[model samples]
Target chain A: MTTAKSQRTVFFVSDRTGITAELLGKTLLTQFPGIEFLKRTFPFVDSVDKAKSVLAKIHDTAQKEDRPPIVFSTLINEEVRAALASDRALIIDLFADFIRRLETELGQESTHALGLSHGIGDELVYQKRMDALNYTLSHDDGMHTANYDRADVILVGVSRTGKTPTCLYLAMQYGICAANYPLTPDDFNELALPKPLQPQRAKLHGLTIQPERLAKIRHERKPESRYASLENCQGEIRAAEALLRQAHIPILDTSSMSIEEIAISILYGTGLIKRVKT
Target chain B: MTTAKSQRTVFFVSDRTGITAELLGKTLLTQFPGIEFLKRTFPFVDSVDKAKSVLAKIHDTAQKEDRPPIVFSTLINEEVRAALASDRALIIDLFADFIRRLETELGQESTHALGLSHGIGDELVYQKRMDALNYTLSHDDGMHTANYDRADVILVGVSRTGKTPTCLYLAMQYGICAANYPLTPDDFNELALPKPLQPQRAKLHGLTIQPERLAKIRHERKPESRYASLENCQGEIRAAEALLRQAHIPILDTSSMSIEEIAISILYGTGLIKRVKT
Candidate 1:
């Protein structure tokens, strides 16, 4: 590929939120590390007119960039998908490609529905997700210790070790009721599980971070505080790891992991993936 | 398909979290409403041995169910993918199909690396997502109104209208700093935008829910309270709608929309999609 062609515009178009298209498209793009993708998302393009307008935009981008754009689409409507057919852009329709093979395999025609993926498909499942979110919120950072019995998994970690966001992500994405407790200096002094978490030991998963990263995160939150000092971070991490090891709790290093990676690791380690509804 | 063949086991297999495979797989499955899919996810199957184990599990499930299973995979390693090939199950390798096409179009060879999709690819972008999550948490439910200047979008609605989760989802998924404020009975009295939100009028988006649904959600949280009464919910909805209309803020009815739907609606309506990093 020429140097100019290495920079291309990529569009993720979908009849719904376009999250699936964007995720799959971006994942594919990551394989080619040499290219720089200028990304855009056209969501809720459920009609022929909308598809036409998006195609026009893609055409404009191709003309402006002197290179054809790459389009990843999940448009379910046949007419809308047909309207988006452009020779100038390399359009990869995710659903159209897979649905044909699936139909041949299943011996059934697809519904071609617009928004079933992200739609509220099952009422009870949707309610359960919302319930999990509410439960996670009320129990964040050890706020409601009495509710530990209802939690699918309880995360034990130091502050800013990514406890809150992981709990919230588990609830939002997988409908898992994840509660987190931030281990403090007092708890580490004893090198034991907190009293309230003893009965829930089987559900406990620990997160530890490198002292340098922990200090950096803390310093961003509380500049110039002792809590953000490298020495204090090192002491807390050492004590926390010792306590987790003593209790036989599975531990994950969150130093370079993203929130999604951390959540998935905890779920797999604790056998909580079985509890995920969707 | 025969009635006995309506039920089939589906497996989402991946080298990393299996999130992309599951999401895309489930979305495709939604097209066939008549078939009942029993789904399982096998994440972090990065090696040949792990792939063999998962295939063994899949074979066992197929035999137990008296039918072949459907497997959707995003395994990037060629040897690992080859190991998972089985006649007992219909394996759909998502990356294998697309990467070939992408390679042909881009004239580049894919890295075929594992875990790049959910991994921390760019440090600055990953940190920004965490920053967005922290910002959303601190500004949740009208807290830290002083920091409204830093928000990408401000969601205004009554309690239990799906504001908090939507805000968190926007932050977590898109790295958009979203803040939410709950309109109380006091604000309904004047039918005015809250005083703190006056200067940030352009950043405002409103969420409204059906009275019946609102009452049901509230009753689940606070049963037998006057706050959960349908009549009270009706009055609040009417007043909040009037206030939002008077303020000219865009309104989204959350009666049937999922959190993803609501967040996308708000982002598109407020033109905040441009600010989304990923």
Candidate 2:
């Protein structure tokens, strides 16, 4: 072990996009905050030569640092995974272990496909998600208010409360037709449901943030303006909260939450079923 | 097992957002295409009461159905995770086994804290990602072409070729300042980079899709129109590919690829370092 160093080389290896491996590795690494990770992702490692090169790199790092580097891999191919399996370092095969357990439980052997998780495994679902993404983009900030009827969820929030990114994530990741309406100063004055959202109150999901945070976000976008002033932010948040409370709308505070957290919370709070598995 | 049906109830339980459990579970389930899973996510299960309810549900499902249900979990807290650990159903505790292995290798004990993965673990990185997302959104589809100087990567592709979503994903997920430009007939006719992009040629990454797939995608948006015609799609794709090749810009085929694949490919191909971890 390299007791003198606090940093370790970490590899997120995959046969396709290494996003899943990266996410899982990051989640695990977060538990050890005292250790620093110099991370790299090697995606599309679908060949024997590629796996050999990655193994060589791992061995080199281990020899140089006198510590084994961590490898978080999602390589699905048996041949490639077997080639990469070595005793030089800690190799975490995320897919192989789980797939074996699942295969046993279900009494069926898995396909062991290389890229099914993020590939076009189902064309219909992929098409639906793309369509939903387009719809969400077009309907952002109530651009097309008439399309509210087609939306599965309509997020209402003060400007910069993360309405747009949350809507995009829901649509792109979950295939949910999410439309976000920014609560403007005019809408906050009435403290009632906006005219466009009146009939579609069932789909309304309110997003809120701390006043100071909102002001700081706005200040970055527009410095020294009325819109970026703390007083304006406080008033808008107060009015928005009052409207949400009065209308019996569900609200989520996004000041310290990540997009994943916010999206999952909305799905649970609204009882919105996943249109696609991932 | 019920031979008459292919359905199974699945639970994603976690101490925090449950995103990791859901993602890992979904990836594993995709290998078994024959099974139809009705999935549910229970987030913020930090309390013993919450764990008891989840256990009760799992037990109830196992009794109701001839086969046991599947529960995928990433609960970090030992007490809460232990409460739900049972033999009534298949429990895939993602954190427990991996954390034990990681701890042994590092010669250290994990903090075992709850919700560190998606929480505000680093405020600076979170703010930087938010700022980058705003930048990408504002510069979407060649909006504010003058802002190209600030972009870490600018994606160029024909319309409806998965440019916008890829840009957004790169920015939101990795905190890379990504902007996209849609190539029109005018740019193709000129056979040159767009004037605004000429100065930033090093930052350009081109996206190309199969003509047939592009046609089908366009047809969905605008049916039977000239814009969606096969001939037009073919011509534009040919010209786009030629322009990218002649300009020495790397091109990615988005025909059967996913956004995650495209974004990671761009990052690797362009050598753009991620501004933040996912």
Candidate 3:
């Protein structure tokens, strides 16, 4: 080896939107090996000061090292771009570099082409899927549960019980159309499926959380609300469980499991669908 | 090997609150092999009907294939649990499955301890990153050239030139605060960096999109606007490139690239950062 692994350094920079960039960029980096990369996250794309500091560092490294340094920057502004353009090292501008090329090849005449999206499919499929989602989100009833009539499954739970995020995830990440609902204390006592739910009970599934877990989740938003109180939380949980048990409904306690686990379990138990990759 | 090469199946399910269930579920799935696992997603958990269908299917499958299924259900509802309690299969409930264990391990009363978050990291760091981005967007003062400060890099280009999207992508995806500004008609007419941007000329990088491509992009957004007309787009692109060339600014033509490719290129070129494993 030329030197100790620790001696080699690397950096990462981005504009105002830094979180998603890191998530995707970092995920993609796993393919490389051997060299040690030092990570520095840069947020904000509007400062000459930051660019100057980066430039000075680049110059310093150029004189001291035999091996060239690598810098990855996602420059979004021309001034910002001017602030860091240099010959000292390799620079990557995630947005500018790619967009220019994309414009040339795809924007030549506006074929009305839709770009690929992460609704997780290739461009065409992704567009179609997202279009479907937009329709569902906009046209679905106030419950946000229309065309859910076509759903292989539907989910219902209580407030802050992890419904919306899961539904969108299933639809986007795996292309599942999931609908959700919150159970009120009144529903627990009366016990036929809630009003709108009775008609769809055939596909209905419920997610219940521990009173403590529910309280913990609610506390983050409003610690003092009755919704987050231990006593109130416990009462609702117990009553709900009793009603569900008497009715013999299938349930999953979601206080601990992540979203993927829940979806997998349903697929296994219901035999609704499967991802083709695996 | 039972029927060699059978894919393992994973599902996500939730009733009441599929949000937490889905959020956690998708994150967990990222850990598995896509090629080896078949993932299915379901949302909205009402246990009664969904479970009955599941039971019937499992019964049919067992009677025919003589094998019970391996299912990872989130079963958040007590009713769902009670109903499926008799199933002869491997079953799991995410909530019931992990709560008590965590309580014992944490040595805290589950009821009072409620501040756990799903995402891992520091909130302050995230906030700082966001603050930088907001600052970059609000002010486009061109002081980056001379005593340029606080910018990793700047991007320059004409209006409708993919600056905003590119900048946002970089900031959100990479935590790289990228600032972008349009090369207004005035900049083209004057053919010089704005006063504020003049000092940081060395660090500035230019984005050049082909005229035809620019026209196409503008057309899609505003088919009838004068700016979207190909003739105008062509005129602006040619003039912008000339000005950039005169200033000796390094330029990237983003005409045909995916966001991933663009980001990777910037990271590679800038010598600012390196890749990381997910």
Best by lDDT: 1
lDDT of 2 by residue, A7-88 (tens): 9889888998887898899999898887888997889999999999999999999999888899999987899998898898
In candidate 1, how many Å is residue B276 off?
Answer: 4.9
Give the better candidate number (1 or 2) by lDDT.
1
lDDT of 3 by residue, B1-278 (tens): 22233344444444533334444333333322222344444454456777666656545654564544334444545676566553554344544524343323223323311112222123444334444444444333332333235665577888755554455445433456566656777777687776666766755667777788778767766888898888888888888888889889877776664344445456555553542211
Candidate 2, after superposition: displacement of residue B263 in Å? Answer: 1.1
- lDDT for B111 (candidate 2): 87
**lDDT of each residue in B1-278, candidate 2, tens digit only:** 32343888999998888878888889889888778898878998998889999999999989998678999999888889889988988998888888999999987788898878877668877777777888998999999988888889999989988899899888878788889999899998777887888898889999999999989888987999999999999999999989888899999998888887888888886767653344
- Put down candidate 1 lDDT per residue, A54-101, tens digits, no spaces: 999999998998877999999999999999999998888898878998
Off by over 4 Å in 2: A1-5, A274-278, B1-5, B274-278
Model 3 segments beyond 4 Å from truth? A1-124, A135-146, A243-249, A260-270, A275-278, B1-278
Reference-based lDDT, residue A239, model 3:
73
Between 1 and 3, whose TM-score is larger?
1
Q: What are the models' TM-scores?
A: 0.96, 0.96, 0.40
How many steric clashes between backbone atoms does each model show? Answer: 0, 0, 165
